[model samples]
Target: MSAAPHTPAPKNLGRTALICAGVAMGMTGLSFAAVPLYDMFCKATGFGGTPMTGTAGAGKVLDRTMAVRFDANVAPGLGWTFTPESPDISLRVGETKTVFYKITNKSSRASTGIASYNIAPEKGAAYFVKIQCFCFTEHTLQPGESLEAPVVFYIDPEIAGNRELDGMKAITLSYTYFASKAGQPLAQGGTAPAKGDAATSNL
Candidate 1:
């Protein structure tokens, strides 16, 4: 005998479709929320070598010291020269120090750029605090203009106690400059070009 008329297709196909639609909407919402969620996570956990943001604290200095190196880069076609005035520095944790990054508008036309940065040995990111930095700010320079932007920072003495970061002798701070898209024309939903390829450094 023929198998009982082949089992009929799902009687609740419409319900299945509705469930799928719900899932799709859920994923869409998550995609939109992902950026801010990621930013919050980085600020909280220091994941992916992301650093913490805060102002100066106790200003207490430790006997133990670590080496810190500065790195810089410019996006392609940005027509700018970017470099750290200081190649490297050694300082005690909790000691606030300032460093400069020089940027020159090499193009005849004025240019604008913004910076983004991260630290290496990702685990140490949580402890690399920047009391002041030029990152996230638009740096607009007149044709042939050159300026030195400052970054005043300190290492959290708490880092000396982080088991995950223990045994770390140094940390590298890297930065990249992206062409400013603040006012550039764009397609619908376009976002500012505030990101660039990372140039690693050694501390």
Candidate 2:
């Protein structure tokens, strides 16, 4: 009894469908790329407590020094006791230093684990650099066996010029060990030593 309803042109309807399809494809691609893109951005800018990686020392040291406290943790089921050789250390900015962490497998069977680390006082992350680290690598230990791993790092001298951190006296470096099935192969491997076996690592 009313006038026939108007219909959209076929061309217009097809165009709208194509636009939606394109948008869906773009969104899917972005979702897949988000993780790696964010990781690259963080590693490059040290955003979100991600420390910068350094290939070598800063080559210039500053008279100003800062204390770095070490904190360690073991995720449940890893059956490992992890501790830093020292509670903390103080060093000049841009001065390269190495610290060791001890990890012992207390379980009755062999176990593999990897470490993840981050810096606290997020503001200082951009200026903190690691020249060498045992993190992100897998280590296997037999029952009652222990491994001493080292981390080499330095605080960028640039921090000395940043007015924002002028009053910051110390930074905390924290690590957590987790069970993992994939990562770089074990750095070193050995069986549980005999009760009186001579040890090859110190600290």
Best by TM-score: 2
The per-model lDDT (C-alpha) reads 0.79, 0.80
Q: What is the lDDT of residue 136 in candidate 2?
A: 75
Q: Model 2 — TM-score against the truth?
A: 0.80
* lDDT, candidate 1, at 3: 68
Q: Which 10 successive residues of model 2 have the least lDDT summed?
A: 193-202
Q: What C-alpha lDDT, on a 0 to 100 scale, does residue 5 get in candidate 1?
A: 75
Candidate 2 has an lDDT of 0.80
Per-residue alpha-carbon lDDT of model 1 for 15-134, expressed as tens digits?
999999999999999999997898778867767777787765636888888988887877677788988988889999888888999999999998778787878877788888887898
The digit string of per-residue lDDT tens for model 2 on 54-162 reads: 8999999999989988878776677999999998999999999999999999999998997766777777879889889997788989999999999999999999788
Off by over 4 Å in 1: 1-23, 183-197
